[model samples]
Target: MAQPHIAKVLVVGSVNGHLADFFAKVKKLDARYGPFSILLVVGNLFANSDDHAEEVISLLKNEITVSVMTYAVVGDRPLPRRVRERASLKSGEICNNLVILSGQGVLQTSEGVKIAYLGGRYISQCLAETSNSSIENSANAAEPTDRVAVDPENSVSVDKGNSTAGNNEEKGTAGSEISKEEKGSAASESINEGKDDTISDSPPDDDESTHAHFDKLAVADLISQVAAENEKTFQKAIAQPSIDILLTFDWPYGAAATSPHTASDLSPPSTQFASNKISHLCAAIMPRYHFAAGEESFYERQPWKYSDRISIGRGSSAVPHFTRFIGLGAVNASRNEKQRWFYAMNVNPLRNISQGTSAPNELPANCTTNPLFRFGKIARVLDTKSLPRVLSAIDSSGGGNEASLSNRGGQGKRPPPPLNYICHGCNQPGHWISDCPVKGQNKRQRSDSSPPSGYVCHKCKKQGHWRSDCPADSSTSSGHASDALSKCWFCLANPDVDQNLMAAIGEEAYVAMAKGALVAGGSAKDGFHGHFSPIPGGGHVLIVPIVHTDSLRRACEGSDNAGADQRLSAEIDRWTEAVSALFAEYDCAPLIFETSRCLPHVHTTLQMIPIPNAKAESVKPALEDLCKADGLALAADYPPAQHDGYFALRDPASGNDLFLHMPKGSKSFNLELGRKLAARILGVPAREHWRQCVVSEDKEAAERDRFIAAFSKHDFTR
Candidate 1:
């Protein structure tokens, strides 16, 4: 039999139906051809088109060697078109060999991979921006020297024009960095290579494959649809359109706490909010197509491809699992453009009924079992036939209306998944005790309820027990350690003896996690940032005022006063000047961050630490120190005196430790003790506050050396 000549072609188009159609044909020709070697398809292939690209890649790899590598670069812009002028410049990247056959002629390389860049200006722009930002970010990253520069204009290349076919057997020029062996295989005869050669000029025509592709596309479409529906629901709950849908990979499941939401949601110290809806959700997934033993057939490829296929939707229809959209509007807007901040105290999932105070015999109305509202044990599994129906149900008229309750037979229905099932002991369906295990448990001790008991312990493991009853640990201790390594009244708050004396214990935990890696060296293998950075403006500091809930109301009680109290205003101004001066030393400008939405007993301030030319990683520690350092210095100047006892005496030799001679006896020390000391030092009316506590036994030399090693080498002046 005569051998048919193989041709490598480059296809440029929107990567949706077209790419699927092209790959479908290749799959059908699997037995007929040794391999379809020369192929490069490029387009806006992220987001929706990403799945389609995977299918094409899978089909190609099955018949080819692993040496044949494929590349998919997300264009700098959104799909359909790309930005050419601003295309990302990936230096030293070459797509050398692939045989090229086109409408024009058999041109360029006869055995090489064809590299193509599809789309227009926007995509190119996105690519360029991403590449540049990456490089700049690297340069400003913890490892600054390894950053690379990309030449945008000259990044993409393709051999062009017409060339002779049969007469010219001349070797072709390869552009990209493809291997010689793979190049040889591109034009090799299928039968000669001892491989099947069944693929003809005709394209693929298989109904089953077509259906599968359609199903994949439908799934992608459904994700977007569901996302949109959820957004509207989120907006109604928060009374704002700026609510963001964040998917938290590590949030723990917990019952509702007190209504911290109503007490002025100023980041923390303020109580966390409570939502009426159920938050914890769990669901079982079942596949529609399960193989019957007698009917199933085993094969290397044929039957395996047709094996029992899985689909989505394993949970009950009556109680659909929903993800919560945390309203980030107030906090997001309050923060300076790109200033970084950490979430201090996290809000645990509030239960439908109050914990501890609730009765064992009766579950909250939201958690009770009602036939119309309860999900059936045997849920409908989604298959190709059922998937479309579910998607329609999610997007249809009934689903679009936000107020139209998903739960049946009442004015109130549990909102989503985590809330649907409660603990068996507590009669809440959201969690089963077997799986309702407490977090931070010993690896071997984690277990859930066989018998539904309302009493869950929150201590030792800190799950169901109150803070007062928490098991005492060696490391846990009371007291807020200020940034300056001075221990004050805040440091003595912990009952656990093992706790470190740090104001921001969470931040301290983060630093502990990053201990051994080289903190300042650069590596080529590390992610690259462009020569320029995306943060356009120079670094700046923002000073925010913190007012107690009582103080704010007293000041605002008068009808004649329409603005903030004079004393609070004066304090904010004084802090602003001091903070601005400090930022100026680092070549950064200071901006004030203040909000008049004052709540009871809560006084908080926000500071924006401008990094200017600082690397992202370096900024974290620097700013953290700045906050701590500022707090420490402020503590030193406060009214507290030696006898007042707010400040802990550090040995200076034992860094970040307290010189605790004895635990405070009730008669020995009281709230007035620290307050009196702080008042003596600062000549102010302020009490011994947690924020002003000095961290004792701090090793300044070691910390200073760490800062020098971590950031001194970087040119922060830029």
Candidate 2:
């Protein structure tokens, strides 16, 4: 009876009742324990009374085998009242093979005194529960195995080779007894509870599946929230100067299924119909933005930037409204480093700014009334697919003065120049249509930005010199020294002698020439002759035809025509009429007469000069004044002084000797007319013959001789 009862009264070793009691008292605290391969229990179990100990052991043995171990000192009472008293055990009752004790000297036994310390035996189902009691609870509330068995439900095999005849029969009966549903439901409940507990108590898993679902959900939710919040913001923004909504989606975000997917498989939020559908849906619900998912980037990792193309009033934030077009690009992502909020916005408020108030930092103010603004309209018209219809509409709407469909700031009175996408006028990349140099002016303020390479020679299609700087190309090169244009016939024979060499040069040198040449050209449409005409006193009515002297001589001497004189007269007449017609049609002023008889080949005659610095409002009146003095109506022949102003200034005392008055401090005494002009204008003295002279240095003589020789080959003078 004692053996069977003791087997039922199993021990919960290593865990003391005091510790368990303390844990039980603090049961409200969150206690989390889970399946682990190792467990270290630290406790003294001797503090519990025998009755309590017996009860605890019963609980332990119901699920697992039990062992009783004790660590007691000799000085301590052998049995306290809190635990079983020494009188309760018989003298020889202590079993050597059953319990383990540490630091024991002796145990009172009926037969003899014996030593006991740190010794124990394995227990075989000492605390095993009866089958009836284990299956008493419904499977719904059942727990996972508590004994840490490899396979708890199939525990009959844990003891190894010893065959259980009764266990086989028990297993057969257990299998037949339990239905599959019962096991499945119990397992499912255990797994669900484990998962829920894990999620609440532990760090979330960082698996790919988890992140993918999270990202998708987050993006969708964010889109919805942003749309809702910004809808009202967008409405208020519309009443201000400019209103543009930009939507960009990173590639590799959607379209993952269309093809064997790589990073590029993701398209930008499609500007196509599908994207518009999304936008429309959003708009219908909240009116958050006008458009979403605009055109995709032409390249990966790039997005399109947009401008409204509006001409907002000066000092107003309206410029952004009209400049709205997309700039699609793939810039390096490295540019994102050191980024800041309010990056390009004006931090200061502009409440009291007036229409013409100077923009901060000298930037051009946004102006509602500017000629460049009107020029943008022309660009917009050209940009749209329906140019013809737009043109018709423009013509119907009073041609150049058409009221803009939108209140874009375009109160300009002058027409813009022809299309020039890359404007070298200001020596900067990304030119506006207005920035182009055309018809005498570039709209932007000029800068002294020079190309890395030197200027270029357009006549020879060579670098290092501009046409103005090419002696063989034009008279300007003859006027200076240091770097003389080569006089080889091939170089000299280039047809576009007067055309700026900078325009034809390599990009680097060409840009340099463009910068310098245009600056001297006075304006885009204006030639580089100077403020005064090449031939002074020539009025706006003069026909300034810039012709190559050699070409003129060839035309004069060629036998290809029936009459060379007649051809020459006709060519001159044709040019004369063209100039007149151009003036009348475009309301241009007049051409001046500034011819150089010295250069026989290609020499430009002063056609006309519009009233110098004519205002837009006064342009018509100035043209009227010029037309009233039209060359056709004036004397058919120019006066002798007009024809030969330079020779007219020759010394009267010694006509052939030409004892001319040279300036006092001339730099070089040169024979060329350009140097002579330089000396006269600069108050420099000369020191050589008209054909072989020097003003200040021999550099001038060398340069003049080079130019004269080059110009003479085409002079056609016998």
Candidate 3:
């Protein structure tokens, strides 16, 4: 029964050491727009070189008392290194009211507005480290960063010779102690690592390059730290994710070209603003409101609508998703002091908006040809996957014209659709892709759309179809997005899903107690009734790999070489030995198994079911008989381990276990067969069904505590 209520959010441009000006601006706004909640500050928050930066900091700590909660993105020049270390190193308090918004940082206001941030312009990490020389001498962060970002803008007035924001500082804080292993730390470079460096070819130490390099490096490092702390949340969001207000430090590359805006209308320096990475990230996040600062000009686009291309559900809708992007001008660079404008956004629950008579705040998307010329390069120097092959081909031409390919944006340039392709069903302005109302007129209409149905969207506050699943339409789904981690089970890749259920972390793997284990304690006194009692078997833990991968056999298939694969194959053996050791310590037998359903995520699921030696002896024969009945090869002896009906199989010679699936078919069939045979081998008829094993967190934690207490020495987590 939750309904949409209007919440106002304010966004300010840069505050380049002008903390007093910032406080003044918010005060004036409060008098005019008295009741706004979140205040987003873009541009350079703490001036790296400003002598008065300390005064500004003091003002923030002592003078500023406005209740409108504020968050600032790291701008062209990030906060002082001390400040960056404070925010990134510990996520420490910047001030009582204003917090520095780093990557993955969110500010939840008292009035219930959640603002998410992904800041710093796109820059390559190689360019950042190689050129800056600080990372080369010794770049070890309390917060790890391997990112490429643009140089700080020249508009930032700094001390005559000071390196902007610790680019070439080559020193950590005094008295800070770092171990030998942590010094000069480098991330395992993805295959795409050197692609961005190809553009520069040599280390460029120019002011522009250095500024770009430092901002991106710092921001990326901050982001990595934030992600590490919230590992469970970020891993889960690889699939469908929604956010309310998303803040970026720069306008998304090519975003100005989406509607009637030309390149000149967005920013005068559009030529220097080519970033396929930023553009790709903004598009992927799908936020309701996207805001950016440090642009040359100010722009507030009408809400733009887009359709979900890959409809995961049974059907789709043409009432295109409503997303708005706003750009605020630099506070110092504005034409007039009074010309600077802060945007006010209204947030409301989707249910109230959908039910109320008022339509979504929309503007005619002036689909016009943009006149952008040269721009920044589209980087493929981050990850190997999803490297635009066609774009790579264009860049390889060596014409030095990255803008030629930037025009297409992420989806590649095709001419806009013919204007005549209208939706005949809805009679709306835009042509429908899948949102047409009359797609199936002869079929039964959805009963849940009626007002009197008394239905509410479980995801959001909308009365909609019971059969339909909806995305977070406005990020107004009651609880903050960061707090809503229950929707996904395994997608949160870290071992700390719950503090109690986590047992130990291995070099590349971790252990967690399975919920509602196959055979565990029944009840506290009565024993084995349901989700209430902990599983009695002490070794029923899941061996989870840290990386997002599918099958163990195919994890390094395309990426690893022969030697790498051999090592990886050996790690599988080590994992098996670890589980075997755990069970043997308690005089039990280890029945480790793995299976994966084709899901959006790549993380593989491996379960270690420990049982009595007698039950364990029956498993091999039970699996053999079940495979024979299903016409599946004996899993352990099967030649191919990565086939469709995949389940874990051990190789006798190498002692390495790989997933063995039936040659072909969906994974579910063989997985079920494997689980059923496993249950039969263990002589547990009730636990034969996978669905029945799903249990509450408390029971899982109880089992986890026992394992943790027994095997505390095996913990290898960073």
Q: Pick the candidate with the highest lDDT.
A: 3
Q: Which ten residues in a row have the lowest lDDT in candidate 1?
A: 298-307
Residues 1-718 of candidate 3: C-alpha lDDT, one tens digit per residue: 5333345556766655556655766766755653554566766654434444545445434455545555677665445544544445424334444556554455444323345566666655324444333211111111111111111111122222321111111112211222222222211112234332212212334234433222333333323322232223223322222245667776765455434432224332341443444444444434567777746356655444443331111122213344566666655454443234466645642222333322343323542211111111111111223223222322321133333223322222334445776443333334342343343221122333332354344445555433123445323444543343333344332212333344554335556676545656433244223322222444667776644545665654534455645555555556667667755655556666666643323357677765555455566667667767756665343334333435665422244564445444332244445456556765666776544565443345445555554554343221
Residue 535 lDDT in candidate 3: 29
Number of clashing pairs per prediction, in order: 117, 65, 24
TM-score against native, each model: 0.20, 0.18, 0.36
Candidates 1 and 2, the one with greater TM-score: 1
Give the higher-TM-score candidate: 2 or 3: 3
Per TM-score, the best of the predicted structures is: 3
Please list the C-alpha lDDT of all candidates, in the order they appear.
0.23, 0.23, 0.45
Question: Model 3, 241: alpha-carbon shift in Å?
Answer: 5.1
lDDT of 2: 0.23
Pick the winner on lDDT between candidates 1 and 3.
3
lDDT of 2 by residue, 488-531 (tens): 11121232222211111110011001111101112323322343
- Model 2: ten consecutive residues of lowest lDDT: 2-11
Model 2 / residue 436 / CA error / Å: 9.2
TM-score, prediction 2: 0.18
